[model samples]
Target chain A: MRSFVALFRKELRSYFGSPPFYFVATAFLAYAGYYFHSDLIYFITFGFGLNIMENFWQILFVDLRLVLIFAVPLLTMRLLAEERRLGTLELLLTYPLRDGAIVAAKLGACLVVVATLLAGTLVYPLLVYHVEPFAFEPLFAAYLGLLLFAGVCASYGLFISSLTDSQVLAGFLTALPLLLLWLLSWNEAAAASGTLPVVRAISLFNHFQPFSVGVIDLRDVFYFLYATGLFVWATLRVLEARQWRGRR
Target chain B: MIRSELLTKYYGSVRAVGGVSFSVGAGEVAALLGPNGAGKSTVMRLLTGYVSPTAGRALVGDVDVAERPVTARRQIGYLPEQVSLYPEFTVRRYLGFVGEVKGLARRRRRAAIGRVIEQCGLGEVADRHNGTLSKGYRQRVGLAQALLGDPAVLVLDEPTVGLDPVQAVEMRELIRTLAGCTVLLSTHNLTEASALCSRVIILSHGSLVAADTAAELGRRLEGAGRLVVRIDGPPDAVAQGLSALPGVLGIERGEPDGQAGVRFVVLASNPEPVQRRLAAMAVAAGWTLLEVQVKPPTLEDLFVRLVGSEP
Candidate 1:
């Protein structure tokens, strides 16, 4: 745990210290904020009912999802690849710490950075309160689902980052998998036929749709957790494999 | 405190390190000597838990490196050859992080970071971003990080490959100061090893050929010493001139050292005759002997001889 703290602080400090970390965080924050609030003032001045808040919440949820998908890869790309390229991974590995702690601390720190950006979007909700304070349940549900979805994305990005020393390669490979998951639900008719149950089950965005609609489905929650676990496990395996290859 | 028994590592079908076995007790410094790709760094990688051995095992303080890696790695500090760091981090935060990961308590962790920063001469740049430092400074940062937490074993690969002469000397002294700290530093710089390490391990093509004290390896590999005589006289004349002198085995002309000079070395089973030939050859041909010096068996000689003999 102490080791994890050390690693976590290093990760957080690294992000705050590097220009890229700030640049990426700021860029995503600006873009996602603007996408959700271009018409926020207009809606508020005219006075909206609960329905307006719901629509805003829905748009905000989508915006949150977009942030999770794109911003996470940027953050994770350098987590392992840059360390490997710089060869500091050797120095870090030699420390009296476990590989999981290293991975978790880094991954956790990035999630916090992303969460901070997501937290920045709270301004929109406060704006909604001027017209309607609205219900807490649905909004909280959507946010929770967004977090679950982001955890899965971040873990997958960390996995991709572990596989290569090139940040660009890690970023592109991570995006490739994410793009498929994001767009996978588009073929709903194919999923409906039941022939591609496995394919549909693998699509994260499809599972996320239940939460986006404000329904707390256990199956979807289970699926997201499972996806997160799968990627975390894969990342661990990849790190272990790297050692074997590096030794010989 | 550290030991390896027949540790071998393979990458797909390619073998990077094979059948290496060596041990270092606490307060001892073992130097791994080899040319590039000679598996010196690979061995460090295995012992430090950066990479796992494909076969056999590495034990650091009785903790099997692969099976209980986290526990084992906690006892080791590694300075990789690349000397890379988190460019944005200050030396303090970086080492603080490293100390934390090593499981030090907060107060002790801070103390350790401060000590290492001072020890590695990083005090001047403790707050500077790692990316902004010079190569020498970056290497110092790498060294500083490796020193964090003062683990039971320290594994450094080519730790001084890029420092200037003065800095290299300082680095050597620092490594020696760490004598009581169990250490394994690898380098192609034989002089560095002689000046710093107590034991030298020679690796050629991933195999351990000889491991001994610096002087012992030198004496065992090529024996006492010999001299290379490069002269302006004809090759045959130089050869004939030095031939049959007591303790002289023979003479052979080497490739041209320059257009005007024919270079040849004399192999004497003993050192005395080589010294005698230096004077005799200088007078015999008025040959403008460009360079005539007796060379002793050094770690470099041992490295070259062992590597040259590898099949």
Candidate 2:
């Protein structure tokens, strides 16, 4: 437990000690804030001031998904790649800690960065509540959806970071799979065909739609948890295989 | 406290470490001497559990490294070649992290960090970020990280590879202070091995060529000794007299030393006996013998003889 905490703190310090974390955070907030304001004003003038959560909340989440897809790669690219490139991974492996602890600490650090990036958007909801107090339950569900989505993306990005020592390659490979998953259900006609159940079951858009409408289905919650666990487990397996690959 | 039995490793088709076996008792300082690609680093990696051996076993203290790597690693403090470290971390924080990973308590981590910082001469750079440090300071920090938790065995590979003479000497002195633990380091510098290690293990082409103390290796590898003499006498007559002496295999005459003196290199099966004989013969011939010195073989000589001559 202590080693995990120590590793977590060290990774956190490294994330903030460099320029990349701040760069990604600033870009995420800039894009998210810009879209949030535009959508909110569009609802106020064009839709006669309906509940902000009903009109612009889902749009905010959709933009956040885009921000997450970009920001997650930046946050996770250096978790293992930088360590391997600098050759510190050898030293780290010699320490009296399990490989799982190292991976968990790094993943935890990435989630913390994602959380901080999401924290900046709390102002949008605060501004909504100040003008007209709306149903808070749906707002909570939407924020919950964004959190799970960020976590899932961060896990996949962490797995990709373990594959290479080049941060650029880790970022590119991480974004590629996420971009595909994000666009998996863009054609509704294709989604409503014979592959509807299978496509909807796997699509991030289908699972996240429930939370956007204030419906907390257990299946959707389980799907997010399942994806998070599967990727985290895959990351663990990759790290375990590294020892074999490292051997001569 | 450390042992390897028939240890071997192969990188695909290339053998990096052959069936090599050796052991270091508690509180012994040993050095692995070899050229590039000689499996020195591979052996260290095997013992540190950074890589598993292809065959045989490496034991740190009583635990086999491959069988229980985490348990065995708890007893070792390893500083790899080139001294890789996180460039963003300050020296203190880096060592603190290492201590924590080593399972030291919070209070103990603080104390260990302080002790290693003082022991490694890192007081000046304890708070400085690693990326901003000089090469020498970075090596010191690397050493400091390895010293945390006071493990029973220390494995250092080329601890002073790129430092200037002063820094190298200081680093060696720091290693010398670690006298109560089993210290095994691999280095290319013969003088460093002679200065810091009590035993030397020489490797060539991924196989153990020789292992012994520096003096013993010198004596065993050098079958014959050499002596240089400068005599103030007739050159031919001096050479003839030296040749007449017993145990002198051959004599080569060199340029005169002026004032009617000559220098001769006498190769003998035993230089000590030949040196005494030449001094006595010089006295009998009324030759003014300016110098008669035996050239003792060094570790460098043995290394060159073994590594340079290996095909």
Point to the candidate with the largest DockQ.
Answer: 1
Model 1: TM-score for chain B: 0.83
In model 1, which runs have C-alpha deviations exceeding 4 angstroms? A18-56, A184-199, B218-223, B233-296, B309-311
lDDT per residue for candidate 1 within B75-147, as digits (tens), equals 7888888887777677777677667677888899888888888888888889987778888888887777777
lDDT of each: 0.77, 0.84
What is the overall TM-score of model 1 with all chains considered together?
A: 0.85
Candidate 2, residue A247: how far the Cα is off, in Å: 8.3
Q: Residue pairs in steric clash, candidate 2? A: A248-B10
Instruction: Single out the weakest 10-residue window by summed lDDT for candidate 1 chain B.
Output: B302-311
- Candidate 2: tens digits of C-alpha lDDT, residues B176-239: 9997989999998888998999888888999998887766776774656768788998888998
RMSD (Å) per prediction: 4.5, 6.5
The candidate that achieves the highest TM-score relative to the unseen native structure: 1
Off by over 4 Å in 2: A45-54, A187-201, A237-248, B213-219, B226-294, B305-311
lDDT of 2: 0.84
TM-score of each: 0.85, 0.83
